[model samples]
Target: MSGKTISELTNEELLDKRKKAKNANIISAVLIGFFVGIAVFSAIKKGLGFFTFFPLIFVFMLMRNQSEAKELDKEIKSRNLHF
Candidate 1:
């Protein structure tokens, strides 16, 4: 994702990146849910503000991670790389 594309990465590096991507996806999903709950609570208590838009950032990150993971999976499959 830095200077290297998925196809440019070595098998070990690809696996490592894939693992990190998956972990980030999980964390992002949890954060999005948490922020959403907070946003709902804040909305009920007061009115819409920063909290309302905060979860959207996490949603974007989750989507980005999913995309990266899918790309990595495709590369891995094309290369026949396995755990």
Candidate 2:
């Protein structure tokens, strides 16, 4: 199929896609952990919240990435501005 890859998207779209992907990835990871925790506990394991860490880490990374992307986009647009 002919579709824009991450690199092919515009800066704003790229940032938005990254944010969405990060969030979804984090959520999926957390869910996997939850299910894993359940399975482990069901088989002589202990309780832990380790999986919750994914969301926190993702939020921080996503924020930073988004900010950087915005800055880069601004810089590019400024340079390309016609006066």
Distance from true location, Cα of 33 in model 2, Å = 1.6
After superposition on all C-alphas, the RMSD of every candidate to the true structure, in Å, is 2.5, 9.1
Clashing residue pairs in candidate 2 are: none
Residue pairs of candidate 1 with colliding backbone atoms: none
As a TM-score, model 1 comes out at: 0.72
Compared with the true structure, all predictions reach lDDT values of 0.82, 0.54
Find the candidate with the highest TM-score and give its number: 1
Provide TM-scores for the models. 0.72, 0.46
lDDT of 2 by residue, 1-83 (tens): 14864345665665565466557666766765666555556555434455444445555554454554454455446546321
Off by more than 4 A, model 2: 45-83
